[model samples]
Target: MNVETITKTLNSLDQLQRNTAIQSDLFSIEQTSDLTVAAALVKTLENLGVRYAFGLFGGGITPFIASLEQSSIEVLQFRHEAGAAFAAIESYFASGHPVVVFSTTGPGITNALTGLFAARWEGAKVIFVSPCTSATQRGRWAFQETSQYTMSNTGIFTSGTLFHYATTVECNSELSEIARRLALGVGKLGGFVAHISIPRTIQTSLLTTPLPHVNFSPTLVTAGEDTISKCLQLLCEAPFAIWVGFGAKDAALEIRQLAERTGAAVMSSARGKGIFPEDHPQFVGVTGFGGQNSVLKYMQEQRPLRVLVLGTKLGEFTSFWNPVMVPSRGFVHVDIDPEVPGAAYPYAETFSVQSDIGAFVRAILKYFPEISRSSSVLPLPRPEREVIKSHLEGLVRPEFLMDAIQRVIVENSDAIIMTEAGNSFAWGTNILRFAAPGRYRVSTGFGSMGHAGTGILGAALARNRKAVAILGDGAMLMNNEITTAVKHKIPAVWIVLNDARYNMCDQGMNMEGFHNVDAEIPSPDFVMIARGMGADGIRVSRECDLEAALEKALALTIPFVVDVIIDPTRPAPIGSRINSLIFHGK
Candidate 1:
């Protein structure tokens, strides 16, 4: 669509929002607690029902920060701008509420892009609010000169954060316009819609007039009668498989019922991790990374007739939009945001229905095929556990450690798990068992290192629960915010998959006979480091030592780290694109 068309749709949507009364008088901004611009922003957020706010607020956002303290909203202050933003993203994904990240100009705004990238890829509906050099600084290379729209659609994390649907809120003269826009776009758009490019002058300068009150409670998008009928007919006609992602939260039960009703095996992106109970017999487990061979094999053999994607971009980590596994045979994608259908997975011969995935699935259940929800779940029969276990152990110690994590988490009633990048990521995705919501935090999109340590801190802090972060040895040393873990008093458990090498890079080079150089890391004794950093640390070299260390780590109320050392030689299967990039030099 052209820019004019975009604006037209936005205006119409804005008008629609204003006509709809807010669910409560709670959404009004007629407050006496110092009506600063920041305060106005805070009120707007409260209207949106923002449960958690994370980010560093030093200069520009102080008024909002102080107001937050006075109000019921809990602010999670991070050590760095990026950390704070990432944490906000974490909060958004965990809870289906908007997370607020406040940052100053220049360095603060620049640092936050990575976190926003993570949010966009993970399909988080978060706002990254940063101050632009005030109105006075335009035309001058003042501190941080950014176009809000650019930040929103940087497309760094995933391609889903596309350019066409981006919006930038520049004028406070349009505060009501902005609020209504946020209500319509943020919740309805599905991915990230940043409220950015806030002119510094406008933020600090007193408002010349009262902020306009505009109501913006969203009307849940629903499928039209004809569309619903056509969708049901399409499903009934095909060998359909359901693929759910982060957007699948609301549609979990509906998707499950649909899967049962159609006899379609359920598949999910890593971000959608536990939407379908992993233990469910029909759940084919997560796709991408070193996902499941059994699941992949099942897809290959059954050759599903229709690939039903609800609330997922079906991103590259799902194999760069591969057609071999999921062909373009009547792919049905249901998303609340229209942008998702237009941008990602456009080549799947798709039918993009504009409605919320969960709501759509719920509505469609009445018409779908009938399958069983309770005919006894058949667990993939233990694949000769002892034989496979012995082979895995003999190939590399890392596999057994991976095996142990799966076993332990499966045993634990409620486990919150985090995995850092590199080989351990492959292992974690392959092994982790999620029990409930807010259970896992792995960087499937960015896969950046040093994330698991601090990221787990965010997860644990958000839930105030115990979670194990399995970090590869090399990745753990990047950002030693072990101090944050100590400071927050978060019960963040770190299980270091210690190979002392960038195993993925090393293995890639080795396969190509290119003399795997500089890939090895100095195997550090993390136990001593953790102790030095005031965190409890333990080491496990033998397989038997694994259970004891995990038990000890979980027993502690404070942060704990377990360094599980393994040989660097073992190969953890990675994607073909990474293979092409590393081996074939593509």
Candidate 2:
């Protein structure tokens, strides 16, 4: 590999470093050969600290694949290109490491769209590279040939900003400079950054390289001084409710301080589970359909004077914009994007400002004068909590079952937890907390099923952490990637919540008075499936068996699966069941 010098300035790197699981001190601005662009891409990938790339092998990525097979980085080839991309994204979300993806020129890029889009929604640092038809084939109906800037034009779709043709770089000479610009985008833009290209004739044939260290000047188009001052003034005067979105990641510290100082209640969307620790007294729980049951009850009674949403998109799942589910008062949307506020609630009397989340919160703390405010009253009693706890205990046995899972991880200092999203996510997120980095990861944005199996695989490879996948049976079936896990010797604890049905869908069906035809599933002995996949597994019907099994599995240096039968009839305690039920035609 040829050592290449770096160029370009990226402000996004700082925020990216903290916000991302993939932290990097060095990245290369590599140049490629006619035959060596593939090798160079792999070299650049190594510089980025990537251990794996997801996607199928095709003409454009042939060289990259061949070299990867011989190198340390392993290529995960999946049945569908989408799954591969999702695996890459899930890995990033689960392990916080940057992932790479490859595709052929056209169809490959198309298949990669969903996975890449998922990363954008959930904030994963993904790099997608594709081979294009040669430059000579430009307009003459060559395979997969289009305008040079097509992909770049669409690149900024998830970027939260308007993008034009200029966003894309043409040919190889411009590749490194473009790669540098996009690389800086990891944190600032907080999504997958693409360095798409075609053949050798296009990439290596070009000659100009842009400045590697060019800084992107950030302008807060949405927030002005007046908006900031008014927001701080409102926050200073009242006991506000703290609602965070996945986007609120940049304001983590500020959100924590607000909750600590004002005795404010903190609640986040399911996607924002880790924004604040559930153990914090100020922390209430999740906010929507799948949120912690206690949170909704508390919000109704408190009627916090203002709800400060930091760096969040407060969408359907979080608010449903339902008056009963959210804080019933003025909502202050603190986002970098100017247009997202009040979009979820049309009738809402809202105060919104567009600014960098952390920066604005800092301004508020530093510039706003403190004022006394009454505490927001806590809402309903532990009615749902005691009930759900009862149901969980009765069905699963032993109140310590979930607690034991946490304790086991605590015992294994090297443990890394990865969960598949579902009702299980609420239980998983509520149970675990991260003290150090690279400990817990999940891909909640794409919210794809079948991703857990592959996600755990990717996380194990990228971080080499002792990864565990807590998944619903429905989610596990999404991709039988256990074979990949076993094949790679990337062992992770796979905990399957076996209910013999899609609980979420079943519950929704019950609301509609429809026969629950499609939801019921044949309960699979997940252990047998694991053994078939060349991994060890255990089926625990009794709660007492779970603790010892997890301990034994963790001790094993290979991937293991645990299938725990859970009662599907249980409803999570917290929000009104009517909201979720209504979707079922009730």
Q: Report the number of the highest-lDDT candidate.
A: 1
Q: Estimate each model's TM-score.
A: 0.81, 0.77
CA lDDT, candidate 2, residue 524 = 88
Compared with the true structure, model 2 gives a TM-score of 0.77
Candidate 1 Cα deviation (angstroms), residue 339? 4.7
lDDT of model number 2:
0.62
Runs of candidate 2 exceeding 4 Å displacement: 1-35, 40-51, 67-80, 93-97, 104-111, 132-177, 193-197, 200-225, 325-329, 367-407, 410-416, 426-445, 571-586
Give the Cα error of residue 70 in candidate 1, in Å. Answer: 3.6
- Put down candidate 1 lDDT per residue, 218-327, tens digits, no spaces: 56667665566567667666567788777777667777777777677777777677788777767776777656666566666666777788877666665445455564
lDDT of 2 by residue, 1-586 (tens): 0011111111112232112222223333433223344555465566556777887777666755776776777787765566677678767766555787777767777766766666666667777766665655666766665445444435532233222112333444554655444545543544555545546354344234322332333333235445554665676566677787777665677777766666677777665766776556667776664556567667666667788887667676566566765455678887766678888776887887766677666655544334355466443222133222223244563223456676776546676676666666656655555433345555555666655556666667666667777788888876656776676677767888888888766665565566646878888899998898788888887665667888888888877887888766665332333455464334
TM-score of 1: 0.81
RMSD of 1: 7.4
The CA lDDT at 420 in model 1 is 76
| lDDT at position 294, candidate 2 | 66
